[model samples]
Target: MRTLHEAVLDGLPEDLAPAARSQGGGAAMTGPGTTQSAVSRGQQARAGRAGSVRFAAGRALPLFVRGRGSGGVRPAFTADALRALRARHGGAPVLVRGLSGAVLVLLDRQELRQFYEAGPATAPAPALGAVPSRAAVRAVIAEEARHLTAAATLDLVRARHAVARAARRIVLGGGGGGCDGEGGAGEEHPAGLFGRLRRRGAPEGHTPLGRSAAYAGRQGQVLRAMDAVPATLLRTLLLLAAHPAEQDAAAAEAAGSGPAEDLPRLEACVRECLRLYPAVPDLVRVTRTETEWRGVRHPAGTTVLLPAHFHQRDPEHVPAAHVFVPGRWKTPGADEDLRMAPFGHGPGRCPGDRIGLLITTALCAEVLRRRRITATRPVLDPPGPLPVALDPRGIRLTLTRR
Candidate 1:
């Protein structure tokens, strides 16, 4: 069935400047389980040859758990803690993209409510079967990687400003636009108003769209910067970049393995990732039924935000939670994971887990093998409303390609 989000995406074609009224932002989205099946189906029909890009995940990407872009000064995450999180998620189950076809993201509140009315989805159902899958994992990792990468690329770009400034000072001993004749020195760098400013340094905070574009470009630069990624992942990304169908045979061959075993490990890995470094630092769930969590009292309908960073580290769920030793959660069971939901334990757990795990595992494995990772800047801190997957400060890695 189509969702309110799907309806909104459909509306965009007729009116680029989409208002909040008819699109369900004001009415439909407020309720927990309002369906928009008609809109989704209609859009799918309209999208036609546009393929899945414009129909399914295409419209949902913005609302994708990463959901929104980072708006302001993002806090910093401790390197030890984030690493520990990665370890926890090391071998957990995840949803492969193909398996995840036509899925929708159900938020925490929705999942919690479903517990009472919808029969609890207690048992940890296997997320992804192996079959050389990495799509869901890829999606999440792509988001997170983009988050990290955006921060890194921004850092690099900022650094380039300094480096460029220094280089220019050393060369012409002047600050002027490149267009200017050699009439004076220190006038300005002629890269243009924007280019000149870029050569020098960043201008305070950015606009909303500016931030979005910056984050998007950051991923591009980071990928280019880190050439020595996982061989399989790197080759795949490169091929995808070029001819897309470039390595279908290799991918198909890899997809031949049975995926049952992959579910548990991938889930575990995803949980660990969420615990250590969740895609969203803080997750908010509005109480549907009166409940108590960790001795806290909450009336029904009260909004509660769960900070994965803090909750994951809580002594109850983990022992010495700040460290990035994937071994901590090496033996997690479905029940145990439910309490400590990383990719969200219940139905709310990210549907894209299969793909997410695949990407994270492959990337991390590649990084461990090929690069020496180091932290140059503070990692992302407690997330705010505009939370993203990246830590603004750069995590410097001197990649020595193997």
Candidate 2:
């Protein structure tokens, strides 16, 4: 965790610096005790114009508010915001400046592909390096299951927090015994857990707030996944309910003679869920040097935004793009499915992507095997975004023993 924090914090200044200095671009002066160097120029720009961006960003408010306001300003309304920009700018990258200087938004899939595929020297600088260990992830998932079972009412917010706390415990080796349990399971505090983790691969020379920063970052990632998990599970259940054939296939897979047999249908359901509602719907990158992209000359330090939601749903790339087609991934020569990069793409893609898939798949399979799940609300009509998770409010599900 400390290593992850160091990698991110050490790389931040380089990530946010514009090619040249601009007036009023210095770190925001937030009164006494707030030194100029404490905040980066990019942060100042973000903070200075936060209100404008928050209020006038895009038309995603209704979609974001679906999960009881758990969805926030992360997506940035890429589809709507960039659609209008693309109409004016054509194929060239659209430059935008909010509280910051200049940001080139890449709405088209081709342009985004180029940016993401570009080598590390030119790719958008990574903001974090939080790849949870397999053990850590399994522990958190198990803890999350326990939390869900213990909850008297299904509050998405609390569930999200529970996941975050579990992750924090795993990373820091403190608090409750999620990673220290019996037989090195997720429920007890094992001896030398912290020392072992540290000696195994801890980054030396920790920064002042390295652990804290990493803990906070890990919590955010866990919360985002947790918030999305319930929705994904709900969507999976709703899809299974709507398609009896697929449900039967999944059930058969669950009841297979072998314990580790692949559950293709369940995996497909997860893929569809991610396609419809990615946790981080939009990705932002910045150029490090002056470059010419597709006949357009972009100056050094240009901010490029990859609208993942827009790209994933592009009719040109994805067949039946807008529909929830779980079996699409099972088709031969379905290279287009690779473009459904809800976790972004390329070198800096989210490290937790596979972990998230496993978590969601396990939860779906377990629930389906143990009980009959039914959705009481229309899946299409989501109520709001629960921070970053798309939530279908009043989505009642009755679970009956199989």
Candidate 3:
């Protein structure tokens, strides 16, 4: 079990530790304090009635856990919870006690943007040294596509395994072959890779233990990419299969003479899929210093939760929020808009986003280029509002030669 103090300091930057401790025992402000009493009456009322204990215990905890679980339906549950909260609070930030500590949930887009722009509150930028070049990535995608094309029907389960192998090759290096017989049994196991690194001798005089740790870190990166890339690809395929017109348009673009990276229509489809079903549906940030939103003051060590799934699909802000419209991304400044966080925003954004996008887009293009895809399982009706959750495991695609 974690102590309250430890939970409060979980993600605090080292430099801010002293200041956080010095301020009011690091307890998050739930009501107007002596210093905060000077604020206007309206702010006080809003702060005082921000969130309810019943709401936190009855609704927030379960939905949050479920949202973090595997499978597609969990995110929908989370989005529903946020929608209810927004209805009650009417765009004000809600302060509820999370399992860790006090959490402030931001509902307004502008407030969310402010929080994202506050650099110190976000996690540090990720290291991108191991990411491969475009040509190397394209080669991996082409090889994977060949494996898919050879199959009679593209099962998501098998595709996920193949993507894992490709991710391992891309991240840790030296798997370089088709999905069936690439780097041998060693490529299938992290321990095998670690041993190979040890035999090759450490880089820059790193000890055996140091090399092992480094290998473990890279393995973690591969695992994350494996999860995210496959989910995004699976969802994108499902969307395309359901919307025939869009699929045909994407297929035409894929068959063009232009490079895969420059396919705007295909990329827009992928982005639209992400907007509907984000790989990381919920984003959490811990405040390292005192933060203010509107007139309320959130103490240092407060946990800030942003339900990206809810915000991106909110019908009020996003036109045709539940519908698939790839053209939305083609509009000027759409990519940079904080409203849609397919790969997140600010310093905490996923560093592997470009690589992830490349892999998914290339695979989608390859499949669309040669095969006409139809969704076979858990059928989607294009005219209706799409399901909030799509279980990737149950998704099946039948491919016919174009």
**TM-score of candidate 3 against the unseen true structure:** 0.73
Per-prediction tally of clashes? 53, 22, 0
| lDDT of candidate 1 over 129-242, digit per residue (tens) | 222223423332333333222332223233233323322232223352331365443343333222333344344236755643443233222222222122222212222222
What's the TM-score of each model vs. the native? 0.34, 0.61, 0.73
Candidate 1 lDDT score at position 31? 48
Model 3 CA deviation exceeding 4 Å by range: 1-80, 98-100, 120-123, 127-131, 176-223, 258-261
Error of 1 at 398 (Å): 1.5
Per-candidate local distance difference test: 0.32, 0.50, 0.63
Clashing pairs in 3: none
> What TM-score number comes out for model 1?
0.34
Q: Model 1, stretches more than 4 Å misplaced?
A: 1-273, 288-300, 332-335, 369-393
Of 1 and 3, the candidate ranking higher by lDDT: 3
lDDT of 3 by residue, 103-164 (tens): 67786796877766775465564544344555666667776677766765776656766676
lDDT leader: 3
lDDT-best of 1 and 2: 2
Cα lDDT tens digits for candidate 2, 166-190? 4445444445444334233323232
